[model samples]
Target: MISALAHGYGEEAINIFNNMVRSSMKPYRITLVVVLNACSHSGLVQEGVRYFESMTRDHGIVRNQEHYACLIDLMGRAGCFDRLIKQLEKMPCELDGRLWNAILGVCRIHGNIELGRKAAEQLMELEPQSSAAYVLLSSIYAALVFKKKKKKKYICCSWKVGMGREGETTYGGDWRDR
Candidate 1:
């Protein structure tokens, strides 16, 4: 199922999952995560939400951080910010770096600076040494700047790309220093 999803065969993955369910094979937690992920990648928002709710209700599978992260990723990819916020508010567990990274990733795709900033902040707080949050947030900033200025502008650290000579460190470097 995951292989199908990785190959962009989201619908095929879901079909395989349904076949397993129909064959009376009880899905484990990871199985449901893959199913939800397939739905997210396939743009099956409603189906993903249904599956998330039904995880415990219908399948007796308790929803975990992975499940919520999948749901967040789904909503984020779909640009359903309001719905995603509501879902986040109702999350049973504390939001972790993985979940925040997923949110940051979606924000980058959607160019949502406000939510992206929030996610990036949470991620940086959770994993300060990790560069993923910085990189993604910079992408979001660059996208917004491009949209507004109608041109390419590097928005990394505190410097723009191509503005410095080789070995001079055109980038602003790491955020941990500041």
Candidate 2:
């Protein structure tokens, strides 16, 4: 299920989840995790929200921090900053680095430096040792700088003929500092 979702087979993942439900396979927190992730990736924001909002009501699954994090990622990717802000404020669980980092990631995507700084501050306060927020902040700045300087961002693309990709590829590859 997770493999299908991770590989962008969102419909397949949904079908699996439905089959699980029909078969009475008790879904744990992890099941919804992948479901929400698939929805987020597939731009099924409304569906994801339905599942999240109905977790406890329908499946008897209580939303934990991770669940909230997935919702945040979903809204962030969808560029619903206004709704995302309201959801963040109303989040039942305590704010954590993961949540803040997710916000920072979306801010980076939306070119929202102000919100990105705020997320960075919050994440730094929560997990000072973690470098994820710092790296994301750096990326935000680099993007802003690139726009200001109008630098031709040379996307590094390696091509071994008959290997894989044919055109210039970009490296959004390095998500982890490690």
Candidate 3:
């Protein structure tokens, strides 16, 4: 099932999981992680939430760091920033590099400089030697800068009194900002 998920076959992975349950096989913590990851990759936010809740509520499976990370990532990918931060705040385990990296990546996607910087700070303390956090933070800043510059227009005017001065104006920098 995990391999199916890793190969981008989310529906197949879920089918296998349902079969596992029907066969009276219990799911472990890693099973929840794999299923949640599949849901995340497949953009199944609601299903991921159900699986996350089931891990503790139904199966009595304790959520370790990886499981929490998966939940965070699922929420983050779905743009559930408020819920994601709330879950992060209520975490039983200390924030690890994986979780921070997930947060930073989402912040990058949303162009959230403030939260991205905070996430990077935490990541720096947790894994100072790694440059991932630094790069993500820089990316967020660069995104912000790009957005700001996107507002400034570059106008090209050609003399054409007959045509009411035919002119073309466009954003002059990287096309991504547009």
Best by lDDT: 1
State each candidate's clash count: 0, 0, 0
TM-score of each: 0.81, 0.84, 0.78
- Find the candidate with the highest TM-score and give its number: 2
lDDT of 2 by residue, 48-120 (tens): 8998988899789989888888898899889999999999888888988778888998899888899999999
lDDT of each: 0.85, 0.83, 0.83
Ranking by lDDT: 1, 2, 3
Which lDDT value does model 3 have at 176?
39
RMSD of 3: 8.8
TM-score of 2: 0.84
Put down candidate 1 lDDT per residue, 47-82, tens digits, no spaces: 889889989987999877889999999999999999
C-alpha lDDT of residue 57 in model 2:
93
lDDT of 3: 0.83
